[model samples]
Target: MTDKAHVVIVGGGLAGLLLGCVVATTCRDRLSVTLIERALPEAPEESLDTRATAISRGSKALLDHWMLWEAVSNEAKPIEDIHVSRAARFGSAMLRDAQDAREPMGWVVENVLLQQVLVARCEAEGVALLEGREVVDFCATQENPKLTLNNEEVIDADLVVIADGAQSALRESIGIGAIRHSPSQFAIAVNCETDGADCGVAYERFTSEGPLALLPIPNGSSSRARYNVIWCAHKVKQAALLKLSDDDFIGALQAEFGWRAGKILRVGRRTGWPLGKIAARELVRARCVLFGNAAHTLHPVAGQGFNLSLRDVERLATVIATEAGQDAPFSSVERLSVFTDMSRKDHEQTMGATSQLAEMLDSPSPFVDGLASLALSTLDLTGPIKRNVAEFGMGRR
Candidate 1:
């Protein structure tokens, strides 16, 4: 008789829950899966928070496999066009039209809504989700992977996947080497109601202050559109910006954002996050592996962090399922290396783009700005460059 394989996943966020669903659905009666999370799977209200995310085509494809896309697509708005510009007149701005890619570029999502959908799907698929519990320690032997929770319950499995956040305690416990770099900028995020016409466009404007990204939000039949604003600036300036009255802050945002869309009214609370990147040197060892922020994190300049994590989860699931079907050692070093290879290209591309973009925006030299201006102008007229960037950003190519 075949032994029942058990899989344990730590962290109940998007990555963790989605991974659980994949295993439960693909493996079916072959594997038993359990997910542990510190927060209860509570329903979220309709109000928006500082929590927002962008889902790329790659991630959408993974969700579609599970028939979960419809759950989220309604809450997201397609980014039909994106305008990238600099605050200073010295630099040139580039416009990337989604039509060039023959598909919607991506969808901007609210975090709570994403969690609700994933949690519901996991429950329906027979993935055992344990809430109000945290993993206190994790140990992986050549034979078994064991997780001890704060409540003193222990779970042993044939494989363990870690989806914990960047500062993952379990990752540290497992001796995963990670490198971190501070971006020296903080992101201020808010949901706003526009007092003007609705335009299904996104903006990624870089200024001496920092990058300000305006993402479109879902609106009803009304012609007026809403947007989620994320502004990156020096930490001190971020604090001052937060202190401004709602109307005053809107005025400041309008001065930089222009009247293309109309007046911006605050619709949700504003929150801030320090910008940085963290990457683990190795994602897997023996029967244990890491995913999500536990493996890597990126600055929100491109909103690629969570999307990267989702890619990791999706590929990992595919690798394991393929190996299991062949009765091969899916958690073996050789098989896990396959998963690593799949992520390297995308991760490297995203890292390179974000780093280059951030450095160009932060640089003070006139020569560097001139070069950036030239590159922007060249990219506009260059169809290959524009198409390649759009495909890369959407995870299509």
Candidate 2:
């Protein structure tokens, strides 16, 4: 077995790339790092899968650390306000105005743009990226961890991080157990153009169909640039919804969602994905660890899916980098413990928030709607509680 590098990452997605960027910059001369991805890297192009993320102050801080924030800041729109409402309720709850915390709750960014920034940084940091290569097998022992690539190359390193994604074959190969639950629903995502001034706000409306989220995108001149939408509905309803023409779809959306953004215009093609959750029974061992979706997959109720994974990537990179800096036992059990402890609180909190919201929103009964209204109203009334909730959801405090 070859034993030259200290760390090997098994995925090239956002989480893997972010971890690589952080580790590459911090441990450049000390540790050797390599990243393996199954697909070739490509530039961002026009696609119907117009997914976007509400990056919290915390996420922005992490990105700023590597100096990539400025590069992609132009593609983001700060969410100065958030309007949340229940379809059954007469009035909506507002989490805006000053004193809504110290900053504009969070910034919304396109997924394609974010990916482009991360990929560029990874390349700039001199990370050894092996594209079109796959991890066919991985075996971790007490002394060393080894990975076999599809290119017939084998690598033995002090630590191996599996970031292959939610359906991670690495997780399965390692004999790790995870709980998978289907929420009996699916999310249809699309991008729509609006004819109004961009208010720098986000809207989330809960209906019997599911939760529909509208996030602002950066369009310099007017709000007409476009907004990203994720409409969750039952599997049976998805087909009919997707069959509507763009104009008819906008009319349907307007009926459900009022003129919050003035006039809604063109909509890109929509893509549907099943809603589910996956949480590994355990996330760490002696010399191997799981980060990103490999560890947990939450319902995308609050757009915390990728940001939560970024937090994991950051924490794991810090733990591993600090361990690499020390002279004592490398990849020791204690090092793994550090990762476990650091991520325990945040992971539990995020999982609890998203899972609870999913369950609460899934029930379309009047009672549930009343409960939802009361909860939001209470959150708006209580400053500390609301701030904490916002911080947890925005990946900041």
Candidate 3:
């Protein structure tokens, strides 16, 4: 019905909404974008998620370029340093910005706040918001991809983006298989307030039982040290953790994580979920492509999941914008292949690093654990190595 190429995105989670905003902002009037989401709007504070995500420097750069950084940073807390240690071990790694010394490595924002910002920006950019509707079926590889809603209404698109969750039926129906790489593990997330000064430092503690992470977060108008915790464990340990009282839980976490950031005075509600890695066997096919969790879902050991997805969004936006009005949108499998190839390195590197860390620390070999402890110490003392690791965490790679 219009000259602009039609691009239909299915899903409205953080990934889906952010992709819509980034693409709309990049292509402007050159593309017509529509988002099909099933969830209706809710009160801002009544969130579906209570967890927070770390945004790397590379991701911040993309948002900065797109002029959306301010909205996110307004509610984000900068992570100035990261402390890595092993439970009851001698060696530790204190990672700081020794390189370019640009801005803080990254920032942490609540998932709810981020969704609010992305949704607002998406609306402001004039992307058609076809919310409160579900796509019952989709055929994304045709000359003109088609989406059928629950109401049996059909819509055609020159290109289709699938940003649905990791368990995406649409991606499976379209013939994309996933490679899951993870052991039997689960994650428990909780927020806490500290009794000591927060030095804008995040912590990653590796224990014999599991790995635990604590990221800095905003504490409203108060100056108290607030944090979001991510604790990973096997089934039995996970069950034990969930069964503990709040006070006992804090005590157990304090014992595992130590007092580098001071005592864990109090904790908020806790959430738990099974953890794993899910990567699509193929990222693109003809006019169809996968984005966000639909393409890859990762372990939170390294806090790279959402940031990696944002990087993918930026790359796709630039590529799609470049080809707009010059080619038949994403109708070319070759063009989509270019995107896949260009993004492969980052994906492999990020996903590999996350998986390795989780598996390495969870190894049953005492020798490997000793070596990992030594590596942490060596990295801390080795200025160059520490700098490189810090930058990698900052998303420089």
Candidate 4:
């Protein structure tokens, strides 16, 4: 190995790629990064990812700092307004971009597009990309951390970052316990074509069953308006809905979402996944650390999962930049402790708020429903409350 401190990142998904890019650019002279991904990066002509993430303004700024916003701007659809309402209830609220300056509250981009952009940025920044490689085992020591790939190849690094995702085998192998909670819900995702014009509007409609979100997406050169749908429902209902025909699924969605976005014209390939929350007990151990979903997996009600993860990456990069030196670097206990201390408040707040919202909104209790309605009404009438909520969603807080 070279004299530079080597950092090995497991997983090449959004979090891993973003972390790699940020570290490679921010600490180029101090560290060398190698990203090991299990699968090869998708080709440009491959199908667009069905899943979408709401990129808050804070995350956008972070991407801009990395000089990646320009490459993804054209493909991202800005959210100018967000409408929140409950089914057959008087409580409703609308969040407008004007309330938070003229800038977009957030932008929506497919996972594939984000991955492509980050991959390109990583390549340009000289972050070594190892495709089709998996870290099956790892050992963290005071001097050098080691990762054993499936092919029996052992790679040594000064620090190891796990971004392998929610079901991280490496994290489990290292005996890092996670607090898991299942709200007995699942999320169905698909791309939707609507009859309305592209006005950069998004919707979050809460039903008796769960919360459904419709996020705006770029219509490209076509005249049709498109939105990404994330419908959270009970596991049983989700299973039944997933089996429905395309037309039937659209009808079901229209019933829950109403005609706010106009009639749902068509629905693309539908997919569903179990929804749950997982937070690792400890974020850092010796020379190893957890990032992104490996640190926490949240419900999608607030669309804050990826946004929060990006913030973690941002703070972590800052800590590494400040603590790293020729003598003391990423693997030292001092660096890990500082990182943990700095991140605790943000992590607790984001996780607590997200978990509470998911549970309260999805509860079947009539009292909770009344409280939810009252809360929305309060948010609608109170400017301070609304602004605070909006800023929180934008990852400003």
Better of 1 and 3 by TM-score: 3
What TM-score, computed on C-alpha atoms, does each candidate reach? 0.90, 0.90, 0.94, 0.95
Whole-model alpha-carbon lDDT for candidate 2: 0.78
Question: Where does the lowest 10-residue lDDT sum fall in candidate 2?
Answer: 40-49
Model 1, span 154-269: residue lDDT tens: 88777788887888887888788998887678889988778776667778878776788888877645456788888888888899989998888888888877776677766578
C-alpha lDDT (0 to 100) for residue 299 of candidate 2: 76
Candidate 3: tens digits of C-alpha lDDT, residues 1-397:
5778988889998888888998898787799899989884453353223578899998888778878888878788899889898888778887888657868878998877787788888899988888888988887656798899998989998888988788998899889999986657889998888887977899898877668999998877556788889999997898899999989998999888888888888888788888877989998887788998999888898699888888888888877887686756676778778879989999999888888788787845978878887888889889888878887888887
Cα deviation in Å at residue 326, candidate 4? Answer: 4.5
Model 4 clash pairs?
none
Model 2 misplaced regions, further than 4 Å = 1-4, 40-49, 97-103, 141-143, 220-223, 326-330, 377-385
Worst 10 residues of 1 by lDDT: 41-50
State each model's CA lDDT, in order.
0.77, 0.78, 0.84, 0.84
Q: Give lDDT tens digits, candidate 2, residues 31-144.
A: 777888888445335543456778877888888887878988877888987788766565466666346356687898876677778777778877788888998878775378
- What's the distance in Å from true for residue 140, model 1? 2.3
Clashing residue pairs in all predictions, respectively, total 0, 0, 0, 0
Candidate that would win on TM-score: 4
Cα shift from native, residue 65, model 3 (Å): 0.4
Which scores higher on TM-score, 2 or 4?
4
- lDDT of the structure predicted as candidate 4: 0.84
